[model samples]
Target: MKVIKLDAIDSTNDFLKALASQDELDNFTVVTAENQTKGKGQMGSKWQSESGKNLIMSALVKDFLYNNEQVFNLSIVVSLAVIETLKSFDIPNLCIKWPNDIMSYNKKIGGILIENTLKSDGRIVSVVGLGLNVNQTNFTELPHASSLAVITGNTFDKDILPALIIEKIQEKIGLWETNSTDFWKQYFNTLFKKGIPMPFKNGAGQNFMGIIQGVSSIGKIQILLEDDSVSEFDIKEVQMLY
Candidate 1:
C-alpha cells in the first residue's frame, strides 16, 4: 500500500514499470501524478485530462498471475473496482464498456490500460494504469467524455477515490481467485450494452449490427450476429459505435 504522489510525470505506468525492473516492489504499490504529459490509452490513443483535476495513477501487481491466459482477469478485476468505487459516490448508471472502459449513463468517464511482464522464471507482474475524470468539467472537444462532477453534479476528492479503487481491486482479486465463475457473472452483468442491439465497426470500417452476448475467456467480445450466430472478436477487430 505504499503510495507515491507526483506533481507531474510523463506516465505513471511507465514510472512504475521502470521502478519494478530496478527493485523488488510490493504488490499494490501505487504511483499517482497530477499531470501526465504523455498519458496513453488503449490502441495507442492519448489520454487527455486537465492537470490536477482528475485521478491519474498506476499500481504494481506482483505474483497475482501465473499464466498469460489469466491476464484478462486483471481487466475484469480493475473494471469492477472502479465501477464499485464510483457507485459509493452515488454515480448513477455505471457500467463497463467491453475490454475495460468505465462508463456512466452511456458516456465515457474513465478508462484502464494494463501492461504485463512475464518473467523468465514464470512469474508475472502487471502495471494497471487508470484515468478517471474526477473534478474536471470541460470536455468540449471530446463529446463523449464526461467527468464524475459533471455526471453527479458533485465534486469529489480525487485522493480518496484512488485509494478506494485500489482496495476494491485487491478485494475483488481475492474473490476471483476463489470462485471465478461468480466473478465472471458479475462482470457480465455490468457489461455495457449487453443484450442490446447496437452498431459496430470492424477493423476494415464495415458497419454491422449485433448484440453483445458476453466476453470470451480470453477477453474477446462475443456478439450475437444477425444470422443467429455468435462470434468472438478481439479488441482491435471491433469498435462499438454506441
Candidate 2:
C-alpha cells in the first residue's frame, strides 16, 4: 500500500516498472503523477490530461497466481474498480467499452493500459496504469474526451481521487480468491452496449453492425454480427465506431 506522489513524471507505469526492477515492492504499491509528459494509451496512443487536473497513476501487483491464460481477469478487476469508484460519486451512465475504456454518457472519461511480466514459474507481475479525467473541462482537439467536472458540472478534488481508486481496486482484488464467478459476472453485465447493435470496423477496414456478446477470458471480444454468427477479435483487430 505504499503510495508515491510525483509532481511530474514521464509515465507512472514506467516509474513503477523501474521500481520493480530495482527492488521488491509490496503488492498494490502505487505511483501517481500530477503531470505526465508522455502518458500512454492502448495501442501506443498518447493519453492527454491537463497537468494537476486528473488522475494519472499506476499500481504494481507482485507474485500473483495469474498466468498468461487468465490475463483478462486483471482487466475485469481493474475496470470494475474504476466503474465502482465512479458510481460512488453518483456519476451517470458509467459503462466499460470493451477491452478497457470507461465511458460516461457515450464519451470516454478514462482508460487503462495493463502490462504484465511473466516469471519462469507461471506467476505474473502486473503493472496497471490508468488515466481518469477528473477536473479538466476542456478537451479542445480531442472531441471524444470528457471529464468528471464536465460530466457532473462540479469540480472534484483531484488529490484524493487516486487513493480512492486504489482502495476500490484493492477491494475488488480481495474478492478474487473467494468470489470469482460472481465477480466476473458483474463485470460482464456492465459491458457498454452489450446485446445492442452498434457500428464496428474490422482490421481490414470493413464496416459492419454487431452486438457485444461478452468478452472472452483471454481478453478477446465476442461479437454477434448482423447475420447471427459470433466471432472473437483481439484488441486492435476490431474498433467500435460510435
Candidate lDDT values, in order: 0.93, 0.89
Model 1 segments more than 4 A misplaced:
none
lDDT of 1 by residue, 4-105 (tens): 999999999999999999999889999999999999999999999999999999999887789989999999889988988888888999999998999999
Clashing pairs in 1: none
Give me the overall lDDT of model 1: 0.93
Among all windows of 10 consecutive residues in model 1, the one with the lowest summed lDDT is: 173-182
> Mind giving the per-residue lDDT tens digits that candidate 2 earns over 32-87?
99999999999999999899999999999765546688888888888998998899
TM-score of each: 0.98, 0.96
Please give the RMSD of candidate 1 to the true structure.
Answer: 0.8
Q: Report the CA-based lDDT of candidate 2 relative to the real structure.
A: 0.89
